[model samples]
Structure formats: structure tokens, C-alpha cells
Target: MDLGLRDATVVVAGGGRGMGLAAARCFADEGARIAVFARTRTDLDKAVDDLHGRGSPDAVGIVVDVRDATQVERAFAELADRWGGLNVLVNAVGPDVRGTVESLTDDQWRTAFDDGVLGIVHTVRSALPLLRRADWARIVNFSASSTQRQTVSLAAYTAAKAAVTSISKNLSLQLAPDEILVNVVSPGSVASDSLLAWARSVGVDSEDPYALMAAITEHFGHPAHLPRVGLPEEVGPVVAFLGSRRNSYMTGANVNVDGGTDFT
Candidate 1:
């Protein structure tokens, strides 16, 4: 299905790798002019090259930490200068920390909140003006399945993501008058660098990341319906749809791309 994203100007925070990069590639494939934002210049450059290879001639990468409102504003300003206006905003920046309530420190909680909750707040606030200027605008927020099914060691992370979910719902109501749709996309376990690091930290073997992930999932995350873990690409298309003009009637909704993990 054509997402009606051709020539649309899109901004994807944390688009250097993982699910963010996957979504960026999907949008670009549909002929969207993409601006991928990340903190590391090297990662941003690599992501830009990858996007260009995926047929995004107008794709560009900017170095911006979503934790900083000023950086987010600067990035959006640059995007506006380059693309004229924004049609889609994907908030994908998040910290990879995981800890149980007893094991988590105050600093860890603050850091996770800053990255997961405040980051979305900063990005959306900076992008609102440009989004309002577009003929059709969509906001897709990346959340985790943990928000629905509380995990043993993800108390802080889940709380932060829950805050993001609330923010998305509120923003959907606030932006509805301007015809901007805001929604949340919650993804299940995916094979990414962050996941690999998490597994290693938990004493899971790092030599074979997928094997470790499989073992962990079987013990903790195995759902009743799906027999395998989800892929970043699998989640990306859903996010692209939520951020596309094709999604006209959906707003303030939480769509789970969790391989049928019964999140209710």
C-alpha cells in the first residue's frame, strides 16, 4: 500500500541504528525526505550513507541529543531550512538501561526518565510548529512492551515509557485541532545493539546475541502466540504507517507490534 508519504519531510530522532534506522529506511523507501537525528557524528554519517543507499537522495543526518531541548530546536530549525516543513516526527531516542527497583539508583532513574520521557517532550515541543505548518502531520512515539507487561528488572524504564505514553495521548488531544495525529508504538524484544548489551550485562553470553536472547525470552518474555522474537524491520513498517498520511482516523492509540504478546 502506498503510504502517501512521497515528498513528505520527516524527522526521526535516534535514527542512527536499530528500530529508528529501520523506520527511517522505510519512510525513505516511500519517497519521504528524511532527516535522521543522533548524538554521534560518526553514527549519523553512517546512517545518512545507509539512507542514501536505500534511495533517499534528500536524506540528511544531524547530531542532536534529544535530552537537550536546545539541540532539538536547532535540529528542527535546520530541518525546516532544508526541507521547508515537517510532515512526520518519530520520537525514537531512548536509553538502554535496565534495573530492578531495588537495584536502581536515583541517578539511573533520572537518566532513564530524561532519555525516555523528557526526550520525547523536548522533540515534540520543538517540532510542533513545523508539524502544524504541514498539510498532514503525524507523530509516532517509540515505546516498549514493558510499559504494558511490567518486567522484573525494568521498573525505571517502564515508568519512563509509561510517561511517554501519557504524553502522546495528551498531545494527540492538543494537536487534534490542527489535524496532527499522535500515537504510540510499542515493540517487543528485538535484536539490536542495545539488546545485546543488555543481555551481556545480565550475564547472558555475548558471543551469540540471538542465542542469548532466545534463552532469555524463553524464560521471561515468551508469549502464548508467537514462537519467535520480533525484528526491527517488522516494527518499522507499523511505525511508518502510524506516521503516514494513510493513518487518518487513528490518534491517541497504542499499537503493539509485539508478536502477539497479549498486552492488556
Candidate 2:
């Protein structure tokens, strides 16, 4: 299907790795101008090269932490100055905080909000002007199904994602008049290096990421309808479609890309 994404300028915040990079790859394959943002210079550079290889000749990567408003602004400004405007902003930036309610400290909660909630706010705030420059604009924020599911040991992470969902809903209302669409995509257990690391951090031990995810989800009582955990490539195309012109008239909605695991 033609997504109408050719030449559309897009920013995948935290696109250096995992689903972010996967989403960027999908966009690049659709012939979009891709700009990825993340803190690690090495991952960002490598991702840019991979995108270029995937047919986005103009793909570039920026090193910026979304929690830093100044860095976020500078990154978007640079993209606008170079690309002449922006079309879509995929907020693939996320935070992974693993702790039970009683075990999680105040500082961990603060970090969760800072990285998950404020991260989205900061990038959106900085990219608004550039997005406005386009005739049509869309914003896709990454959220987790953990927020909608009944789970234990991931309270802090889910709390932060809940805020992201709420913020995107409210922001959509304000941006609608301008014809700017804002939506959130919530994913369940997806296989990626980040997911593996997160699982390990929370005390799930496995050499294989997918195995770890299965164990975690089974223990939490939310399992994918599909046989196994998902892949970044699986989630990427859905995001590309939503961010594309093909997805008009859908705003303020939270779309689940989680293998039928979540009702929300």
C-alpha cells in the first residue's frame, strides 16, 4: 500500500535503537526523509547509515537527550533549517523503571516522569514550530500496554506511560484546530536489545531476549495471542502507516500494536 510518505520529513526521537530504529527503518523504506534522535552518538550514527542504506539518502542522526529541552530544540531547529520543515514526529523515546511500589524510591519515580512524560513534552514543545511549517502534521508517541494491563513490579514504568497517554490525548485536542493529529501507540512484549536489558534489570534472567519477555509476560498474566513475543519490524510498519498521510482523521487515539494482548 502506498502510505504517501515519500519525501515527508520525520523525526524519530530515540530512534537510535529498538522500536525507534525499527520505526525509522519502516519510514525510510517508504522513501521519507528520516532524522533520528538519541543520546548515544555511536548508535545514532549507525542507525543513520542503515537508514541511508534502506533508501533514505537524506537520513541523519542527532545526539540529544529528550529530557534536555535546550538540546531538543537545537536538534529540531537543525532539522528544520536543513529539511525546510517537518511532517511527522514519532516520540519513540521511553524510560524503563523496574520496581514494585514499595521498592521504588522517590528519585526513581522522578526519573520515570522526567524521561517518559517530560521527554515527550520537551520534544513536542520544541518541534511544534517546525511541524506547523507543514501543511499536515502528525505526532506519534510510544507508550506501553503495561499501563493498560493489570501488572505488578512495573508500577513506576506504567505510571509514567499513563501520563504519556493522558498528555497526548490533551495535546491532541489543542492541536486539532491546526489539523495536527496526535496519537499514542502502545506495545506489549517486543523483542529488542532494550527489551532484553529491561527484563534483565527487573530480575528476569535469559540469554535470549524473546525468552525473557515470554517469562516476564507469563508471570504478569498478559501474554500475546501470537505464539511468541513481537519484533521491532512488526511494530515499525504500523507506526509508519499511522504517521503517514494514509492515517487521516485518527487523532487522540491510543492504538495497540501488541499482538492482541491488550484490550486498551
Candidate 3:
């Protein structure tokens, strides 16, 4: 599947590492021009080099914190100067705060919304003009499956992702006339670095994907029918397809990549 992504310009927020980096690699494999933005310069530089090795014609990494609208605007301005237009925007950024409603502080709640929801707003708004300049445009925003399944410990995180899903749906409708497609991807447990660290912090002490999933299920109670956590590579294809010209008619949909969740 070519996905018609060659020469397409893509921007992946939080693409310095983890699932965002995985998705950027997918685009790079398709020979896309890629720009990845994140807070860490070191991670961004490494990601850029990896993308080039993966076959991206051009890969640049920007250091920007999505929670800050001013920084996001400046970064997008730089993108416009480099590419002049954008074909796809993959928002894989989110706040890592976790806690129950009662346990979470007011600052934590604000941080969650600011980084998760408002961050999406900042990126989408800044990218819209550039996306409109392209012949085909798509937005793929990451959500969480726990938003649907309802995890007590992930209340703040899930709530923030639910807002992301809502924003994507509304953007799909609002951007239809512009021929820009917007969609949401809700993922379950994936054995990414942050997740592995969390697992180890809780005494899971395993790097194996299945072991991590088992521990995750026992701790978080969000087990899937497949009985294992997914890998970052497993998610890249779905995001690539969604953000590619191959996805012509799908928009305003929340596609679950949750290893066969019970709710779906």
C-alpha cells in the first residue's frame, strides 16, 4: 500500500519519541517530508536522524512545548517558511498526569487540560492555514481507549483525551468544506518507553510486551481480548493510513486500535 504519501509534508507533535516517533517512521518509510516537534532537543535530533535513515527526503526536528500557544505559533511559522504548506498533522502529544479525581490536585487537572486539549487546539489552529494550502489535508489526533472503557486511576488522562476526541469530531465537520479530513485514534496499552517506566516503577519489572500487558491488566484493569500490550510499530500503520491520501472518505471517526477491547 503506497498510501500516496511520497513528498507529502507531515508534522507530528511529540514525535521526539514513543508512539509519535513510531508514526513519523511510517511516514519516513513512505518518503515523506517530515517535521517533528517536541520539548527535548536531544530526542528531536535523534528522531530527525532516524527519520532520515528511514528514507524521509527531508526531516527536521523542532523544540516546542505544545502547552504554550505562543511557542506553537512560532514553530508553525517556521514550518510554513520551510514547507509553505502541510498535508498531514499528527498530534501525538499529551500530558502524562495520572490520578483519580479526588487524589488529583487543581494544578494537575489544569496541566492535563492545558497540555492535552489546549495543545491540540494550538497545533490545529496553527496548522489549518498551511493544511488548507495543500491539495489534500488530514489530521490524526491521538486519544485513549480508557476514555470509553473508563479507568478509575486514569480519570484525568481519560477526560483530557475525551476532549481530544470531541475536538477531532467537530473539526471533521467544520473542515469538511475545505476537504480536510480529521479523525481520532484511541489506543489501549502499548509498550512504549514511558509506559515501560511506569510498569517498572510499580514493580512490573519486565520489558517484554506480554508481561507488561499482563501487569497493566492486573493493575489498571483494562485488559483486551488479545491479552497482551501492543507495540509502537503495531500502531504506526493505522496512523499512516489515516493521515494519508489513501484515506479519502474516513473522517470524524474514532478508530480504536485497542487489541479488541470489550466495549468495541
Leading candidate by lDDT? 3
lDDT of 1 by residue, 16-35 (tens): 99899999999989998999
Per-prediction TM-score to the true structure, in the order listed: 0.93, 0.93, 0.98
RMSD of each: 2.0, 2.1, 1.0
Higher-ranked by lDDT: 1 or 2? 2
Off by over 4 Å in 3: none
For all candidates in order, the CA lDDT equals 0.86, 0.88, 0.92
lDDT by residue (tens digit), candidate 2, 90-179: 998877778889999999999989999999999999889988989788999998888888567888889999999999999899999999
Clashing pairs in 2: none
Over 4 Å off, model 2 = 198-214, 262-264
Enumerate clash totals for all models, in the order shown: 0, 0, 0
Colliding pairs, model 3: none
Error of 2 at 151 (Å): 2.4
The candidate, 1 or 3, that scores higher on TM-score is: 3
lDDT of 1: 0.86
